[model samples]
Target: MQSTYNFWLVAISFAVATLASYTALDLTGRIFLLASARLRHAWRLGGAVALGVGIWSMHFIAMLAFSLPIPLGYDFATTACSLGLAIGASYLALVMTTRARLTALRLLSGGILMGFGIAGMHYTGMAAMDMTPGIHYQPGWFAISLAIAIGASSAALWMARALSNDDARNVFQKRSGAALVMGIAISGMHYAGMAAADFPLGAVCGAANGVNTIWLAAMVSLFTLAILIVTLMLSRFDARTTFLVGAVSKLNGQIIRLATLDSLTGLPNRATLTERVERAIQSSRRERSLFAILFMDLDGFKTINDSLGHSVGDDVLAAFSQRLLQCVRSSDTVARLGGDEFVVLAEHLASREDAGVLAESVLERMRHGIWSDSQPLQVMPSIGIALYPQDGDTVDTLLKHADAAMYEAKRAGRSTYRFFERSMNEAATRTLLIQSALHEALSAGSFTLHFQPKFHGGTDSLVGAEALIRLIDSKLGTLPPLEFIPIAERSGQIVQIGYWVVRETCRQIRRWIAEGLPAMKVAVNLSPRQLLQPNLVAEMLAIVQAEGVPCQQIMFEITETVAMQDAPKTIEMIREFQANGFEIAIDDFGTGYSSLAYLQRFRVKQLKIDRFFTNGLDEHGAEGSAIVSAIIALAHSLEMDVVAEGVETESQLDILKSMQCDEMQGFLLGKPLSANDFGDLLKHRTVAA
Candidate 1:
């Protein structure tokens, strides 16, 4: 019997197939982009169901478009089976095309399997008609139809493989064209399969009452089309989810950074280091970074505290931390672990040996760092290193192991570094043995002043001196100023020690004048605690007045660190000292991060350059000379006398003279001498007069 196809229904079926192909292909592209497994699975499952329904709707709608001399209807059971087969085939097709590397062999195999699935669905839907006389197939036409089904399936797989890997929305026209070709191939296969089926002239549908005819097909088609549309909308939402995930990740990173930084040293702690590194790994999948945790603490840092006071220790820690920053590359992370403890997070090293070299550089910088010149301070870092992956894969484990190694370095006689090992513990502590001795030594009047002469830059004649404090202990013999100063400062003894110093220096000045000797200005270093004393200016003026010495003969030197304080009271106190006739000088000028505004605010009469800048001047002439020259010119402009401390070697002396330094104090001129020796020198100066 001859049957005619309805043109409108046939066109609608093709449209449904194209829309389904476009949606499925777009989802496949999304699957390729998604790094999350859950998202990929969602798109994959949704694409399969929607595309499956669309394929089934196309076949059913096209079948309903046919008109025959005999009645035609579908059985409920068989029609449902056909729909299941279509969905299964679509799912299998999507899986094969969405592979990361879709080779020809894989595509060919997938195409064959999917072809059979589609053919089974088409033939099964034909069976749903249940023609009474029974439907037959033309042998040659049947083979040709089956061939077309397989060929079209292969073409569809090829199209999906080519276009699905890219962001299809970016190449919109190209993707649409691919979808159209796939749609035409699918429709052609369905039509050719139908052409092979023959309905006998007396045929009547046995299952005519099982399901409705054209209206049911239209309803199914509309519902499946809606599914495809929804699938496309979800693909768009997937892109938004990606953008939101990035924004959230950045905010999390910011919170970690803001929360973990140490206020004093401006370094992160152990707690947030791990979380940040983990996030880094997620964002950069390909990089395998090897980090080293150089756990360290200054060996004699407490000495800086004991002698100079905690305020100076804090400033030194801050300055040394900055020096530590400059010694390493920008990629590394530096963290302070409270007090003098610090960790350096060095990244992307090739081997454990590279971490060792980096640790060495860090140690070198800390050993020769900025300081108050008279203390003989040796606050070297006792460093311990732990490497990544081999030493530890986690941040906490690495830091812990590294700290153990650092203690090992301390035990092995500090001022050196060691790599991490399992058997490490028992750090040596010198505080218990010597801290008590500091108290006894102070009570027994062990402290004495040694004078280092400051000479005129041009005449090389002694114009003044700096009184550096020392400790002579019966138990520990003679101790360097560094040994007991930080201990004294730590125990609140430095304040009293400071008062003794002022009184003793005044007495020595009185003795020299009584001997009919020339009067010379002497600079006495004041601990920060002493500088903060409420009656400091009054007490100091009283000492000079009691000794019958002029206030100009005894100048009080506050460190550049103390001079940098912006507090109103501190500034007022400094003004009070100057107002009371005691000339104020800022010691360690280059080392302290003093600002020009603060410099102007203090209005000190003299600015002393710390040894850190002087030691490098002769060697690093271009860089160092430029800095020294700037300081001298700046000091002159402010009507302040410029003194270069730690000026050793003729080269340094000559350089200082060329720069027009007002005064120079260092070993090159003379070592610090006793009060008796200073008197004898003064006696000779009187003889010269």
Candidate 2:
């Protein structure tokens, strides 16, 4: 008897087979695109299970649609074996495709194994049917079916690989189209295999009875649908998870940028600069190339900031940073070290001369001035360059040496550049030594005060004295103020040192008063750093009060440059001091760039003519006389007493007396003496009186 097929059941079976094929191809394609090596294997295995079981299920379901004239049933063992073969083949195929690049050999090998496995499954399922007379196949039709299976399997593998490749565009659309083609190919192969089998007519066959064909078909369809639904849900979930991961990665990158970049200039910060320098060092070692570091400080930035306000200062800094960027190559890094200080790392430099050229270019760019709020503000750069290998090896050493050279440039004059030299290193070493020694000196009481007396220019009578610090270390004996004062200021030890000076001056003055000596105002010089101390006025007053000295008997002297550093704050501080009965004097008056208007604004008691004008008064002729005369006249107009500093000769004193200068102090009249020597001098003067 010939086999009779249920047309509707066959259609439903093919529809189910097509759906399963589409679902499997889509899953396999996604698995191929996975970036993680570990996750790819797990996803591929899951895909193999779906594809293998679905293919086997489709064949079995289609088999149930066909019926012989007699009863038909399946052996449970044989059916299970066919399903196992299909899954094993799928696993092998997926492994082949994903293990390496999809070359022709790999694709062909994988396709052959999968095709043979599917063919074996179809024939094995056919053998499960219990019939007295066994079924046979036509050789020609069987060969055609086998060919169809191999061809369709190879094409499916190729299509899936193409979709996974990065070069492919419109991946989703292409993958969808590929799925439809795969479904058709798989369904066609199944039908061809079914047609290849022949069931003879009038054959006496033993009927193996168990489940109905329609019920079996329904169960397989339901199972295939469940598997497909699960696969679809998983694919969607995977896509959502990937999108969330990508979004988080982008957010993290933004946060890192914010941390490493300057908010105003948008340049790298100190932390980022340090990291880049380390990286550059590594690269230079590998490439055997040289690099340079440039440390730049904007000269007079404090003046501009105080005069024009911080908002304008910010605008100027932003504009200057843009110009700085234009002066360097894109490969170089520019970073801000906070508060008008910037650093540049230039990589792959040819020689030290290249660094010089870069430094000059930076200076030239800064000369043009930055425009802010419709006003052009001019600021100059003091650039200090340190070369790789020549300057120092490590980042800290280079930065330290470069900063030392920058101060050298500032001392030479503003608006210049200086290359790091061996002398700078020596200076740096000395500075470090002084800083270490200073702390020890402060604790050990190695520092003492020396009194330099001022005399009335006309009468040559002792009037007052200036308190000077002397550090007498046992080993380093008698270090001058010039030797360690700058170091103290730079190391931020000036504030403590200043307080000591105030307390010691008060103590000496109180002792002199107790001895029945005439009370005279004693002046103490305050460093620029000390002037910036927030509690300066209160701290000094407390020290003087604690030592039982009258405020009027002590004078606080500051240089013009120091007074103008933060003009408004300086004015307020000076007012506070004056209000407390402390006298304020401008020391080294003629040397600093201060306007007469600002000088007049100060509620000061005295102005001391700087030493440079007084030293060569007899030799300098009219120019010297004119400057001294003008200063005395100006001081008289401002109702402030004028004190001539560094008056070393009788002739200089006569010139100051002629100019009506109030007082004079120098080595010629009285050398700086110990407190005991000053007391003896006072005693002798009292006896002379």
Candidate 3:
């Protein structure tokens, strides 16, 4: 009992002696943060210094609780070796990163610190020299100290090994919290060992002796464990809240981008474009500067999309966008208005010519042609330029004039640019007036079909008649197909217009048969857009059956260019039409790429040579006669009939007859007239023959 009391007294003295050194080391570590401006790097260096100071403090603090009875030489050797191990462990911990593979650095450092701290504490406890002068060795004290040192080192080293196996866990793992648990466990082991150590032979053993030891051990253990668990729970809850907040911020950014951007082309959409334009207008007005707006449309894009699939069409549009970017300055804003349409806004332009030159550059680059299926495909653009203050002061006026200029550019040959002029507004007004009148024509049934007779050259007798469409506005006397067909096609009103043609043609055929006229075949031109419709053939057949007209008496004509778009699908549709007793004719054969392969594949009834070729046949010095001869011979070999259109002279008719052309339909026979006029001609022909 006297010896233990002396050990406690020496431990207190050693703690008081080391207090000033620990305080100085901890204060010096804070100065490391000022060496660098970067927070993260400075923190890394500071953290290493803090760890070194912590080990130093832990060592001296442990000395206050343990006492040793070793000679000065042994004490010096053990303390030097222990400090050396601690310094080496701290250096190793510096190289280890949370980003690298986990290793035993933490456990090694903790084990080294604890090992030295225990050694220091044990030596301090033994310094009192309360043993007898005989200096008899006691195995019980040696065993107790050895057991406590080995137990504490093993526990710490095991924790370090576990931490080394997983890097993620090491980063978030509660270091101080875990150290607290370990500290309590080690304290319990030390107290239990102290109780087990046998003291002097005369020493008294009492109930109060073990009672104080157990009470102190329990109090320290429970207090340390409670602190550890609460710290860990609070840290994890804070991390989860931070992660959820960051995720919501990212989602909100994505949603905002989608709302303002165009889904298909990734350009600012119409709403966003309008907002930006308004802002530019306001800025230009304040600065008293000029800006130009150019509206561009892809020329012949509809033909390309219809011929190829929409997938290829998408590639062309994307490529065009990239090309457009190369033509404008970085200050300009370019946006896609819709399909094959784009608009550019250029600020602080010196003149409208600047916008025109940019538009020309875009067209020149596109004219070189793009590749499709490894073949060169041509694409071009038509642009209309409207200057801010020069064309109009308001947004609506600028847009209106730009649209008129674009139409003017299209009228004056595509692949060109046009500047807005005052006169263009008159043309625009005319277009709008025509649009209103056409709508009235559709509702009032003012449009009519004129039948032109088709004659067999060999027999010189009527075999069939082609149904020609015409529109009669109330104000205007009569309108040709070219005047209104394109407008209808653009507005997607051609589908309805086509339906009207079919129903009215069926009604006319029934009337011809009812009037005791010969049962003549009636042919009607079908637009490619109409032919691509899935239910078109069925709808036409239904109209013929409903109107009491024979399907064989109705012939449907489609252009050669339209038939080549999807040859397989076109052939299937033709086969269905033939099965229903409706003859198919390729009208305007030579205008586009007329392929013999497509002709043989589709196997139609007739080919109507375009008027351009027929009009040339009468010129003796021209090569038109040779072209006509080749076409007729080709048709004969394919077992298909031929019809020469626009035949206006006897010489042309005679030449066609010699070429073995099966039919002729032009002004030479009779111009397309009203149905009643054609009926009168039929009566006159019957009497004359």
Candidate 4:
């Protein structure tokens, strides 16, 4: 009973040491990685070595505490050599691309290899040990010990690798049955090897029944079997704990990815970008180094999307992104903010001229464009360049200036480059003022819609009028569409403006009905926001019903640019609006991406041809006239009414009449006026008639 208790204590002590060693290794490993950020690979290797040493020390100490009869061996060099070989082999495997993504099986293979090394070391040490008095040459002990070490190492490596790969909670869920088998196998091998260890030949004192070699072998087999069962149980418990540790590791990886990466571009997103930029900026400021910020925009990308298709455009963008990365230095950073725009932070530029030269190089590379297949495609990048300290003191200032310069490049020639100018600041200030005023104007009811008569081409009689939204800023007087529309769109204030336009238009239509005036269709332009909103359809329907107006008399005009932004969504929206009895027209048809395919799919009732083509109809004759003629013909073929916009002169109106254009609206017909002014005009038209 006392012997049994002592055995239990020894087993418990070893188990406790095993647990403690693993806990210590995990804590040390985390600290090692955290401390060695710059030399991560070297530190990680050191950490592994440290863990092995720790384990080895713990095992030896525990054994000593147990006061086992096993004596110390000479030639500890074999143990060091084995460990070194194991570490070196593992490193080779880790570095190889073929084995870089290490799996449990590979780890197990490595562990087995290490086990051989460990076993060899153990046997060599045992062989050198002075055990009792004289033991003869024991080849069996060496072979058995070698095999036992190899098996144990293999099992340990496999278990460690498997546990590291899996999450603690999920390890049991995806339990590897083979892993458990390997564990049992390793324990069985150890017991068998120990039995085979040629202990000094001695006499059996109290075996009276039999003392044959076969009986001795049978006794060893039974002993090994009992040890195997116990080993298997212990291994299972250890595996469970290993899996839990693995789960924590995987969770940490996920957190790191989320914190550092931009999900869309698969690039160092905002957090990482800021960190890198801040570091670079600080270094530059301290060292008086020159760096450049390049703000890039793809020219006419929106047109390509509205014209060719968005999918083709996405391919263009992705390809362009790759090309942009190829143009920059390895030390530089390239990031995509979103949608047709990218930013490059170039470190350690030689001078301002260097920034310009790099910008030009990038622009030149972008000029040829990327060909997806055999087809040669063309892409243009407008790059705006800003230099550190000279252009701005901070990242935000540099980026903003660079962005402005990029637009300047676009305005000058597109597919070109430009450096930041002092004048850009004034322009930005003006834009900011306009944007601020727009919000105030919306709230104070300073925004009003003007309706301009759209006359039938042949009869020259008013058919319908288009509602144009205009904001009256107290300080800025009246702001034109050109002055504020783009700003509003960028600021996301267009949605509010669009909503007001629709509501006011509907109210005016209702007023006309109340006045018993002849029913005339009124068109209100819908911005991208108005169309994209899931609840927009419902809101518009509500307005129609509340106003008690015929939905057929109300028209919603969507720009070609906005329509192509999301074709599927646009198609659904148009169908829904049409179902509610509202007429849908493709606005600014020829000005932005001309896609005949969408005309077939869009279910649009009309096409509003922009005035640029119509204004020069007489001078360019056939070329200009043909463009208009083709659009009108295309609209006719699609069963769509063509409305010519920006018609100022009777000469343009004459051309439209000859082409049999359905309707027209432009400055010549009369600029957009307030609802009250439009009401007065309607009364004047009635009196004149």
**What are the TM-scores, per candidate, against the unseen true structure?**
0.42, 0.60, 0.68, 0.61
In candidate 4 the C-alpha lDDT for residue 40 amounts to 40
Query: Which residue window of length 10 is worst by lDDT in model 2?
Result: 369-378
Q: What are the runs in model 2 whose C-alpha is more than 4 Å off?
A: 1-236, 247-291, 296-323, 335-342, 347-354, 371-381, 388-404, 410-415, 686-689
lDDT of 2 by residue, 509-626 (tens): 8888789877767899998777766778899888888888889989999998788766788889899999999999999998887579889889699999999989759879888889
TM-score ranking of the models: 3, 4, 2, 1
- For candidate 1, the per-residue lDDT at 556 reads 81
Model 3 C-alpha lDDT versus the unseen true structure = 0.66
lDDT of 2: 0.81
- For every candidate, C-alpha RMSD to the true structure in Å: 14.5, 11.8, 9.6, 10.5
- Predicted structure 2, TM vs. truth: 0.60
Put down candidate 1 lDDT per residue, 390-509, tens digits, no spaces. 666666677778887886787676878899876553222344445666667656887788998888887877788888888776766777776667556655678778878888898888
| Number of the top-ranking candidate, with lDDT as the measure | 2
1 against 3, candidate with superior TM-score: 3
lDDT of 4 by residue, 549-628 (tens): 78887899999987886788889989999998999999888877687887789979999987778776967888999999
Best-to-worst ranking by lDDT = 2, 1, 3, 4
The TM-score of candidate 3 is 0.68
**lDDT, candidate 3, 618-667, per-residue tens:** 66435999998888899889999999999999989988898889999999
